[model samples]
Target: MKEEFQNYIDYHKNKGGTGKLFKFELVEYKPGFLKLKGFFNSETLNPVGTVQGGQINSMLDDVTSLLLIYESKGTIYPNSTNLHSIHHRPLFEGEVIVTAEIIKKGKTIATIRGEAFSKDGKLAATLIHTALIMKSE
Candidate 1:
């Protein structure tokens, strides 16, 4: 990861609201792509002892949004328009590894794909996220 990207993640993990709360860790990065590792702890579990669907969606949203921000070099911010998701299996309290890659980036809209895998490396979920690209202030 570039120092700037690391700095961005560090800043968020330290101070940026839900990013700080979720504690997402960057595992790998490159232009338009990123890998993040997140822990789905006991606090996130639902009644069935599996991580809640909303938590997984939040992580995927962060992954895709952060990738777009990184690729745009902070010049553009992506406002989510849609998130189409599929869950293959329930995720328990453990590490969830997620990867986000840019599928298409237009002047006004961007599309990104994200996948989450359980600690055992089984596919847990997938999301196709679409966002409207907006200029940063």
Candidate 2:
């Protein structure tokens, strides 16, 4: 199962739109929790030379979704219904660590919390994600 999950993430990281661009690495993964690390390059920078809010949000969203998938062992698929992010600080160069934990897992719905931290261990943003869990056909 671990190998499968790793392969899944690798495939997306090499092929998916955001994954390909952000180059996110699946640093750690376990049931109900996961961590992804990446860097915000020049392309992700805003006009002021800081990482854009939307890019951070996208990273959180992707990490949360991947966490759910890993927890489910690929038996269920998730569709995000709601996402709320709060920015705590600006991020420029260096590594970004995204950690996600499942808050509640139900038959039909799930809630997850994700936090993004800079290389220096400062919190950059936090996100709450609500997703609909559906069985794979």
Candidate 3:
């Protein structure tokens, strides 16, 4: 299952969309947990030279969904219901680590916590995402 998930991400990385655009690399993957590493250049920076909030939110959303997919073993996928993020600091021109962990998984709903850390190990942003787990027919 883990291999399948990795392959899924790998396929998407080359295909297109946010995965390809952001160049997210899967650093770790396990049941109920996933971590991704990505780097952004000046193009991703805001006018003030800090990473844009939308970029951080996208990373959190992607990682959280991946973790849910892993936890469900591909039988279920998440549809984000709510997302709340708190920005702790600004990030500029360095590697970013995005991590997601499933806090609770129920029959049709799940709660996931995501965090984005700067290269220097400071918490850049934190997110709590709630999603509906839709079972594949």
Candidate 4:
């Protein structure tokens, strides 16, 4: 990324009050993207002995909101307007990685796209999210 864009991301990341989530330290933030890497433990598996859909959805939604908030510069997002997820295959207990990117950042709303990959580097799920800012400058 260009220096200007980097600065922009940093500026918003700082003044935007996005610090609390840093405690998780599970996700990595790029210029306009976020990546979360982790392996689902056995406890995360559902009765079917695979990662639960709700668990994956929760993580993806959180990352999407976090990224959109950063793109908003400093606005606080109240909630996501629409969230869509597609599970292509089962995610057995193993290492999983997720990458999400902002597709559009409007004045009051932002959209993001992400995908989860298993240890084999195959797509496990695809996510689309839209967030609506609660407060504005």
Per-candidate TM equals 0.92, 0.90, 0.87, 0.71
Strongest candidate by lDDT: 1
Per-residue lDDT for 14 in model 4? 69
- Candidate 4, which segments miss by more than 4 Å at Cα? 1-28, 71-74
Task: Give the alpha carbon lDDT tens digit for every residue of 21-79 in model 2.
Answer: 66777688777888878778888999999999999999899889888876666688788
* Candidate 2 residue pairs in clash (backbone atoms < 3 Å): none
Report lDDT (Cα) of residue 137, candidate 2.
50
lDDT of each residue in 1-137, candidate 1, tens digit only: 56777777776677666676567777999787899887777878899899999888888888898898888777888899999999999999877899999999999999999999988899999999999999987
Considering only N, C-alpha and C atoms within 3 Å, which residue pairs clash in candidate 4? none
Model 1 score (lDDT) = 0.86
RMSD of each: 1.4, 1.7, 2.1, 5.7
lDDT per model, in order? Answer: 0.86, 0.85, 0.82, 0.69
TM-score, predicted candidate 4 vs. hidden true structure: 0.71
Error of 1 at 47 (Å): 0.9
- Per residue, candidate 3 scores C-alpha lDDT tens digits across 30-118 of 77788888776777789999999988888788889877766655678788899999999997776799899889988888899999999
Candidate 4 residue-wise lDDT at 120: 89
The alpha-carbon root-mean-square deviation between model 1 and the true structure, to one decimal in Å, is 1.4
In terms of lDDT, model 2 sits at 0.85
Ranking by lDDT: 1, 2, 3, 4
- Which pairs of residues collide in model 1? none
99, model 1: CA deviation in Å?
0.5
